[model samples]
Target: MTTQAEKSQQALILFAHGARDPRWAEPLQRLQQIVSKQVSGDVLVHQAFLELMTPSLPELIAHLVQQQVAAVTVVPIFLGQGGHVRRDLPELITQLSADYPQVRFTLAPAIGEDEQVLKAIADVCIAQL
Candidate 1:
């Protein structure tokens, strides 16, 4: 069983494929903010991008490791299992795992794969028509 201290040492990383435009990161950052507030103080929520953005995955992981975060879950904020999500991400995770052997990094499915997100997207589409 996981104790409070164990949970406190865990972090959630909201992983996203970044765009060149700064504005592209606003929603993702906002999401990190929202999730951070909702989770227990034991957990830390962060946003990291695959490319064209600051705080790349490796960078964030390095910082978190220094902060003594024991475990991490990476939730890809992508809508589909594209190349980035399917291939690049796994490679990155592999390297990160090798680099930070002490930290546990788990990758969750891409956000769009969730039923809730699909339903919400459908609702928005239906409302728009």
Candidate 2:
């Protein structure tokens, strides 16, 4: 069970590889907003990009730590366990966690290869069919 120490002022850090087209950020931002509203105990949400964004994951995590957040969950908003998710994110998380030991950090699995994702793709393909 996730205790309040792990729950209080919890932040969900959504990391996405940004798009040159600014509009691409919208859907993830919308999803973040929805989840932020639903989670219990003053859930805070932030978005960090692998590139083309002001705050990277390390920077965002540091900012959340400065806010004295009790805990945070880093969820990669990538489509799959691609190169960035497989390599960069883990290294970044490790470095940030080392720098800030007080704040607890949880790294969730990437939203890749899930049934829901497959269904979504199937639905899109079905439309073409």
Candidate 3:
């Protein structure tokens, strides 16, 4: 039986749509830093963009694979299940799976779909009033 410590390395990718302005990425970058610190190197956390940004999803995945990450969890940061999340992401995953059969990629629902997140947002909305 494989030991707990022998489990394959894993990574978390906070996938988001990019904007033309560089500042738009700052919040995600902050999240990446916070998560990395919280994990304390147990699992790597990364940020990647769909367009108008550097380090696209494919690029980040290739880089992580080179570092020998065995599995990856991609969390779409979009507010809803749009075509990009429903259609484009799956196509990208298919290609990535074919390219790197050794790596396992798990796609998560869009962040906005999480109940706890929605509750937090709602609370903050009322607090702002």
Candidate 4:
């Protein structure tokens, strides 16, 4: 059985590879807004950058810890499972797990790799054509 506090202590982090131009994050921000609205109750939906953007993963995790979030689901927005997703992210999650032993860290596959997402992209392309 989960307590109310425990129920409120879950978060979802949308992780993305940041770019030098802030405009690059606009789509991600919109995605965040969409996800945020879909989530009910106290569940948090946040976006963090791997580089060249504010509030990196570690920083966001620290803040979430402060907010007493007990679990985090990290969803990579990258199109492929490249070095950043396959290597660097796991290393970072391992370190964060060590640092915050109480918190459960879950790494989700890259959004673009999902069949539904791919279908959506194709649908858009088809519509444009």
Local distance difference test values of all predictions, in order: 0.91, 0.82, 0.91, 0.93
Query: Candidate 3 — which residues are off by over 4 angstroms?
Result: 1-7
Best by TM-score: 4
- Residue lDDT tens for model 1, 78-106: 99989999999999999999999999889
Inter-residue clash pairs, candidate 4: none
Cα-based lDDT at residue 36, candidate 3: 91
RMSD of each: 3.2, 3.9, 3.1, 2.4
Tens-place lDDT per residue, model 3, 1-129, is 965456567999999999999999999999889889898465989999999997899999999887778999999998899999999998999999999999999999999899998998899999999
Question: What's the best-to-worst order under TM-score?
Answer: 4, 1, 3, 2
**Model 4 C-alpha lDDT per residue in residues 31-117, reported as the tens digit of each score:** 999999999767899999999998899999999998789999999999889999999999999999999998999999888899999
lDDT of 2 at 16: 89
Over 70-107, each residue of candidate 2 has an lDDT whose tens digit, in order, gives 78888888778888888988888888888988878888
Query: What lDDT is obtained when candidate 1 is compared to the true structure?
Result: 0.91
Error of 2 at 26 (Å): 1.3
Any runs in candidate 1 off by more than 4 Å, and if so which? Answer: 1-8
Clashes of each: 0, 0, 0, 0
Worst 10 residues of 4 by lDDT: 2-11
